[model samples]
Target: MLRAAMTGAIAAAIAVALAGCGAAPSNSGEGEGPVRVTTTIGQITDIVTNIGGERVEVAGIMPSGVDPHLYKATQGDIAKFEDADIVFYNGLHLEGKMTEVFEEMAEHKPTIAVGESIDPASLIEVANADGTQVYDPHIWFDVKLWMQAAETVQRELAKLDPDNAGTYEANAKAYLAELEALDAYARERIATIPEGQRVLVTAHDAFGYFGKAYDIEVRGLQGISTASEAGSKDVTDLRDFLVERKIKAVFVETSVSNRSITAVIEGAKKLGHDLKEGGTLYSDAMGEEGTPEGTYVGMVRHNVDTIVNALQ
Candidate 1:
């Protein structure tokens, strides 16, 4: 599908156009100017924009509410990659289908894997039935961890366009400060929920980092990646668990279908527990471009407030 989406003319243009990368914009007067940054997901796009500020022209592949795990790049997306001076994406197979596209682009330009900066020991590893473990790619849920990603962005931007190094530095410092406050807010607000009622049930386990960082027990009907389906047994198991614990709500995600979650809710009702839909949480994706939930900090803030208001 990827090749089909960007075949013949687009593929032929990549090699020729890539030779022109890292050049200043047409109007920038002969020096390294604004970096043409193309990112795979909106979370990474938000980070690049915040850290790079006015120094980057970012084109994000997967927009708000698009699931990166299931996203397949289009012809236009391929063109964005070709035009970019640098490409940034969440690693650990988050953008699974785009792996080949990233590989092809990295050979020509400064393609960065954002998750590389994070410590492996700190990652949440989900074990498959075959006994292999894949590290969770939803690192943006932990504000502190996400801050590291922002730092990575600024560091790379400084390297790519040295003339604007100071600007990137200043922007990163300010953004990191806001992230610190956001992290504290998450910890404190989640702490406000009654210990027993603090359980967060969502359709997918994208919030492992959030739950771990905030000291809440998180249960998901599905696994880490939304690519996996929530089976009937999964629903029954979660339903019984919710009924046993009397969990008041289970949240749905903006990027994922809520059918499994709805099933869980209905099943809980049949078992005599009136479980409510807490609210929609931003999981693998965010809200629209101009909305509060569009940016990383805004998305995190919204999720924290929603969880706290629902459970506390």
Candidate 2:
């Protein structure tokens, strides 16, 4: 079993990591130019960059292929956060490891949790180890929910840089429209997969929101947080499920290890179900900077295209 990872030591550990990194720049001084924005993940970074355009200097703490669930902040990241005019993060524990740092910074900065801005009623509940409920934080998988996040970014950007409020609003309007079109594309492509084969199996439960939005059944060997372990029973059960349902493919995430999914495939193969590896999905991280999967919209399109092609 994985250790209960979210102890008080998390913040203290991060503080220690940032201690040696000398003084960081401040946003308080007069004659500030472009808005210095720091985002916790690439997806959030993409949105802020699109909405802020040439007016904001955006830095993403977690780079491509880094798993946010277990990401630890370095001294340079601390400096970036400290110097940022505004900070945006996906809340509801998606950045579980960085929650403490974000909470502390929220006290004095324009730090915003874009995920928290979504209507709680629309958020999907996941059970924790203590049987308590927590919302799934992978809202970006659902294009519509991501649109909400973009709106929140727009609101925060306007608040932080009122001088460019109109520009931010206009950019947000255009991006939101693009997101609407992306949502339609996802739905259409997903519908192409035969209804019975629409089930999505990933390494973890990150795709719950995506499944809900796209009308597919999603299963994972591990729970919502990757910090949790997939026990033998869980693996066996998933293996049996795949074999029984004749699931054609199972996916690996770009940021997450594929060991669990591989186990499922081996288990199913032993039972005479030959499953294939579906192309990797950008779950916690987007693709490299220059690729289509690097941007949020491009990532979504890539995912839908991969899934439809694999399962069709």
Candidate 3:
């Protein structure tokens, strides 16, 4: 029902947005100062901004603190796609309702799913609400995995604008170095927390990659997608896990409701376990534009610092 409603809205808006828009721009990268790139999700937008550098104009479809799992593309978003030289998004159903929009745009321009470009073996498999298996879409939590996404963006940008391939390469190399440093920082900081206290619980299972990369245990009240509501059983189970494990903190996501987390916390309290509300996490979304947490590196830094400080 949620997906259907979002899709209907998107289809209507897109039709109106493209009413008189002529053929899609050829995007040959000739006779242009910079290629216009449209992307969904702040993570991908940041990647394009860094890798494309001065050679691309980047715009994001989803704003900071917006849940991509439930984001319905607007007419303005359709206009952005129609005017772009390329579009990039995190696939594996990250932009659940926007999948068709991306597909339609792909026929007109280079539409790359940077997250899906990563190796299958590297992805975490989980059962969907219906019990079918799918790879988790929140790949940015793992800095190393996101580095791969950066590389994918660099490669595609080079393909799209060979004239600026050198520029993209140089920019990507620099950005990658920063990400490497960020990854090391996450590893070092996460190591400071005792193994027993390294557990991270969030509103949703958006940190599985982060847990695997940093050797911490991760739990979420809801499933991979926020569309999958947390049932009373889920809250009870998580509550018990926290109490039994003596977990100290539960984190809320900027894009997800804190109601479930609150329920889990109250349940744990009733069982005589005091749980702290760890600072907000930028799961499934980034921070406000221009803020430190708005960028991918800053967002990861914020999350790692928050988790370590809380659980330490």
Candidate 4:
């Protein structure tokens, strides 16, 4: 019912915005300047900005530390979408609240779902509450998977701006090679944390792909979507798992509240186990702009360094 109401509101808002949009701008007169590209998350924004180089002007609606799962589109965001020459987002419902907006805008623009291009078989399938399987949208957590996303962005950009096709391709190739190096670095660094200390407990299930790629055990207090609550049972179960394994640290997420993880910590303490916040992980969003974690590669590196240092 809540989802229905939110959807209704977004639909009405989009309708009004479109109604007031007046005449559509001439597609041919888009001008000989930077291709205005609007992306959903900072990770996408960073890659697009890098790959687009001087050919595209990239902007993201969701800022650092903003939870994408529950982010609702506003009038300003709708205007951004309307003005953009191209739009890119991490699909598979990562931006659950903005699905309608994306669908509506894709009608006339090159709105691309970067994550959807990856082969479905390569995606992690998890059962939903209603017993339906869905692909995990946190593909960016795995550097290799994110390479696929980078390629998708390049393809779309090249298609939209054919004159700059060579540049986009070259940039994508360079970025992909960097991603390969990042993947190798993650594996090497994570392997140094003794086998028994490979467990990564966090606020939510955002690190599944990360764990799968690096051979670590990941457990989270809440589900993949932060919209779901972590009940007492969930916290108790995680606390018991921490106590039984004697895990010393659990990480908090940038986009999620620390309360749930804190509860698990207190629960573990009550059961004669001591735990601390391992570190803050960038789950749904990256770090602040102008910082190292602001970029995707840097974000992944920071997470790996934090986890390895804490768990080791």
lDDT, each prediction: 0.83, 0.85, 0.86, 0.85
Model 1 local distance difference test score: 0.83
Tell me the tens digit of each residue's lDDT in model 2 across 25-138: 443222366788999999999999999997889989898999888887776786787667788999888887677787677655677999999999999998865577888889
Once fitted onto the true fold, the runs of candidate 3 whose alpha carbons sit more than 4 angstroms away are 1-6, 12-23, 26-28
Candidate 2 residue 284 C-alpha distance from true site, Å: 0.8
> TM-score for model 3?
0.95
Candidate 1 residues lying further than 4 Å off, grouped into runs, are: 1-32
**Tens-digit per-residue lDDT, 159-222, candidate 1:** 8787778989999999899999999989999999999999999988888999899999999887
lDDT of 2 at 227: 81
Relative to the true structure, candidate 2 has a C-alpha RMSD (angstroms) of: 3.1
- Give per-residue lDDT, candidate 2, residue 146: 96
What is residue 283's positional error in candidate 1, in angstroms? 0.6
Choose the strongest candidate by lDDT: 3
- Residue 67's lDDT within candidate 1 is 84
lDDT for model 4 comes to: 0.85
Per-residue lDDT tens digits of candidate 3, residues 134-155?
8998898899999999999999
Between the candidate structures 2 and 4, which one is better when assessed by lDDT? Answer: 2
The alpha-carbon deviation from the true structure for residue 188 of candidate 2, after best TM-score superposition, in angstroms, is 0.3
Report the error of model 2 at residue 247, Å: 1.3
Regions more than 4 Å wrong, model 4? 1-7, 15-31
